[model samples]
Target: MQLSSFKSFPLNTLGRDFAVGDIHGMYSLLEKKLVAVNFNPQKDRLFSVGDLVNRGPESSRVMSFLGQPWFHAIKGNHEDIAIRSATDPDYMDLMLRIGGAWLMDKSPKEQARIRQTFTALPLAMEVQTPAGKIGLVHAECPLDSWDDMIFLLKAGKQDALHLEEKLCWSRRRFKDRDETLIQGLHALVVGHNVVEGMQIMGNTYYIETGAFLLDGEHGMTLLDLVALKPV
Candidate 1:
């Protein structure tokens, strides 16, 4: 892990509303889907559910797309791992095992740019949607472990690292506990866990439709916030 001494990027609020699920390095598929949906990079905003890298053949390509101005992404576990590796020299080995190898395989200048981009992603985003306040996090909510929901909410966005484990790793079974029920946020959209199709669990939607699916098989779930529909 070659730790870069750059600061992380803050979360940006954009668009009337648009969202996409886990990319997992399937850059070509993502490009086609964006075209199929007639995505307008300027007027329409794009939100990634996370896991923008790893397990796919083109992590470098995936990062390049994410760097575009039209994209707004929260930090997924993969990004978190890369960040840690980037900042901590000791974790370099771990990073390589995950997806660092692919990222480093790029040209020197390309790798440098990717490192800068990764350093700047936000940990989570809270969007005002018709369905109530929809929170876009990587995976689960950190509020699960806290007995006081108000306290966690008050912590604000600065505490991303403290909540990393749950935000970027927890899955459906882990989030469907009594703790989550008591926390009472409107809905949380996340990725990391692959599903057969898009899932609507309570108000939270898991949209990682396994973009890495091979054999000429790949799928993505697009969420239209205004229409309250997933296509």
Candidate 2:
């Protein structure tokens, strides 16, 4: 089944909403962080900036985590690789080189299940907060305005595919240190490039603190959307 490229969620009035950076298969570490925050999945929601799989020990368990009703996510570059690698032989090498060796161990059935889940994920998501609307993309927003990106993504044409490439893989914003605030969003959250710590540039937030890194300094980052601060 074809999935829409964008999804919008109403304000989570029942409990707090949190946005987490690229998990990269570190489910255990993520669990520890969630415990520290006293996350009650019954009422709370966890939104992932994507890159939910690959690079860590538990990449195989991504489907189980994604199954949780309280967890929401967008498709990241790694997920794109997972989708393509299943059909396009050319992407397999690229996937393995980028720490997706875990996929090789999965049975054909499991791989298909994983691919289907990735294909179902939207490229962009928006969640309403008292502060305003928060936008989430796996990487940088290729366009100047959040609404424009949403419009283009909804179009889902050839140009939208190009923008999707940028959304999942481009790091130009962080590399150039672009501070241009995207219009029509209270804040834009993303993950892909690892930063030394959680950072904010203009209204965009970079929260991926390199959960895949084995170094002691880096761990999973879960940012509270309402407070716009790391938990």
| True-structure Cα RMSD, model 1 | 5.4
Residue-level lDDT of model 2, residues 11-33, one tens digit each, is: 88899899999988888888888
Candidate 1: stretches off by over 4 Å: 1-16, 87-94, 107-113, 144-161, 172-185, 214-218
lDDT of 1: 0.65
Over the stretch 62-166, how does candidate 1's per-residue lDDT look in tens digits? 877765877778778888777676568766688777666886666867766676676666656666655555667777665643224324434553345455566
After superposition, the stretches of candidate 2 with alpha carbons farther than 4 Å from their true spots are 1-3, 214-218
Clashes in predicted model 2: 0
Number of the top candidate by TM-score? 2
